[model samples]
Target chain A: MACVDDKGQLTASARKLLETIENNALTPEEIAKEAALPLFKVRSSMRDMKSMGFVTEEENGAYQMNPEASKLLKK
Target chain B: MSEETMSQVNSLPRIGSKAPNFEATTTHGTLQLSDYEGSWVILFSHPADFTPVCTSEFISFQNIYPKLREMNTELLGLSVDSVSSHIAWVRNVKEKFGVEIEFPIIADLNKEVAEKYGMIMPEESSTETSRAVFIIDGQRTVRAIIYYPLSTGRNMDEILRVITALQATDEHNIATPADWKKGDKVIVPPANTAEMAEERVNDDSVECIDWYYCQKEI
Candidate 1:
């Protein structure tokens, strides 16, 4: 799940999850389906997204977007 | 070298001021800034046509064009590329992307318009224009300006946020706070007294963070 980027060596699946969430909100299953990654991998990515402070999961199980996430999609 | 440097330094346009007028051949025809007299203007510059980032940005803008027009705002896209290049790109946008960009895209082949707007920044691009956005009011005064680095694309949401903020400030004579979006709380200017702040928080619909920091729904 780790890889090197121009920015740094980071988690590959996490980066993939960030890419998926950049365009739209998705649950773990939806992220797995869209990314073609495994369920565990998607969960890992979601965890990474949380750690990066790019997304927040609401109590209702819905995910909320942050300003950084919005900016990333635009970029 | 000093004189050349000074001249180059003097060439950049200042933001929050009057946008210089220019005439350029667009997809629709020749366009002048004066023609959009009674409407707000979103004058945006792109790096190039037929590119991925530019394509997505154009499509997104076109998709929201109707909403923008409803706000009495007109869009004017610009790049240093030629008019034919722009036309082909517009056609491709409609045919391939299924989005129509009805707005006129200014073709500044000579970089005249680009230089006038400080769109041609060598630090960002030596051979192309950078992603620059300018929001001009109905009176043709620059209200807000933004620039994106070459590797980064501009945010349509942030663009619209700035426009909405400007409109709100003009309408209500209030100021927007950091990361302000539509329907979010806006800042109320600091009153000299805590009593005034408490009164503001209690009397206003905005959520009060503290006595000094009062926010209201915009």
Candidate 2:
């Protein structure tokens, strides 16, 4: 997990992906394009990040960075 | 099949071994591995076309294409998809992401290249390739290989960093430390003999934690 730490917090890749999703509600493909990550990676990371409350899935199935992730990114 | 023949067919190229050559159809055109001679190559494989993860990986690879070219390297993507599937997927990616994927993508429908590279891990998926990366030098030797499970995406920054580190080591005969990026101090190869170790003790040019571990500016 290049984007996660031992404490289960977001690191480089996770943080970058979150930043890409900050204001934009995007599909996995869109997120992968925006974040410059592989689509498979974005899907998997989003799953983990979402479960950790770092991101949220909208009714339309797009993803957005949650408030918790924003705070962590700010740091 | 004999054990020896099976091993030869299934085994992946080891570091320092010659990269197996192949000719295949790509989005750009038909290409052979030998065509990339005299340039470094980052040969990678994805699971499928039009899939989310593979799409993102392609986009990311596109983002780094320029940097790789600047380093005298070429990017070649591959999958078990057909040439038509690869073409359609490329079109979709360009139209959707506004990214033009300029690299060639090998359509390994027959799984010939996949078999040679051992890209398909049956435990993960019988039909699809796990994410695999092979870095080959200008001389066509396999320099580095990285593999990720079907679900995980690769770290683009790390990929670039590794290429940089490998090039640096080849040029300067120095090794990188953990999490080492460009401009960071590199580890000097340990002294080979006691006499050289004694000479290394007084070498003021580098910061030595011990005879075997020393750091020096590039």
Candidate 3:
């Protein structure tokens, strides 16, 4: 696998998911269902988003959208 | 399909006009044609990076890379494959075909670049892109364009001939005739009147077949 760029930005797939989840908090399963992504893709995207500071996961297993991703969605 | 349908298919990124600027993360990271402002760009799209037909085409392009570079042109390839897939394909081409590709190929996983360039046709292949080539001048204006069917491979000789023809026209302000090849006689546009035609024959350098037909050795 290729290493991420040093900027900590999301890869293309991760970016697409962040774009999808900007409006509201969605669990990995919900993200996979709504975005037409597979389960593994949702997990990978969530991990990348969390690392890039674009998402935060709750103790109850829900993912919350971060402000950066929210701003991108508004645009 | 009909010519009208093909023209409609290629209408998104208008041919014989400026190619649209597209920024995408390729196998070599973020790239854009605007970055190479002072040189020519040959941006081509393949069905998929690792497929058999595309592999041969890529190797052919790579073999011609040195010549293209000598003419101050750069090549950029594209497909709707992941960057890792592109990397693997490049390695495969080098190892098996004995040619090294020294250009960046856009991954275009989301089909953004392909859509922007009209490279993807759902009617052609729902999951793959069509074979597309756009030759842009130093000013980022498209000079020539060619599209090949999925099964038929592109002619590298024809591509080189077109570049030579375009460059010659730009330098000499002359137009080439149909099926023009390098070092072959070039067509001189007929002068409008009999007086100009009479003067053209006496010019000595140009061969006049008739009053309207004049050929010049390039």
Give per-residue CA lDDT, model 1, range A1-75, as digits (tens): 122246644445555666776656777667767887534335434554565676887675445556666555544
Estimate how well candidate 1 is docked, as a DockQ score: 0.01
Winner on TM-score (1 vs 3): 3
Which of the two, 1 or 2, has more TM-score?
2
Top DockQ model: 3
Error of 3 at B144 (Å): 1.0
User: What's the DockQ of model 3?
Assistant: 0.02
Backbone clash pairs for candidate 2 read A38-B56, A38-B57, A39-B53, A39-B56, A39-B57, A40-B53, A41-B153
Tens digits of per-residue lDDT for model 1, B1-218 = 69976786676556567778876777655567866665799999999999999998998888777888778788899998898999999999899978888888988899888877778788657779898888888888888878887778777788888888899988877789889888987777766777886687676565677767777775
Off by over 4 Å in 3: A1-75, B1-11, B193-195
lDDT for model 1, please.
0.75
lDDT against the true structure, each candidate: 0.75, 0.86, 0.78
Report clashes for each candidate as comma-separated counts: 1, 7, 0
The worst-scoring run of ten residues by lDDT in candidate 1 chain A lies at A1-10
Give candidate 3's TM-score. Answer: 0.69
Residues A1-75 of candidate 3 have per-residue lDDT tens digits of 122335644456665677677777888778877887544346645755576667899887678888867664443
Docking class of 1: incorrect
lDDT of 2 by residue, A1-75 (tens): 335678766678788888888888898778877887644456657766776777889888699888767878877
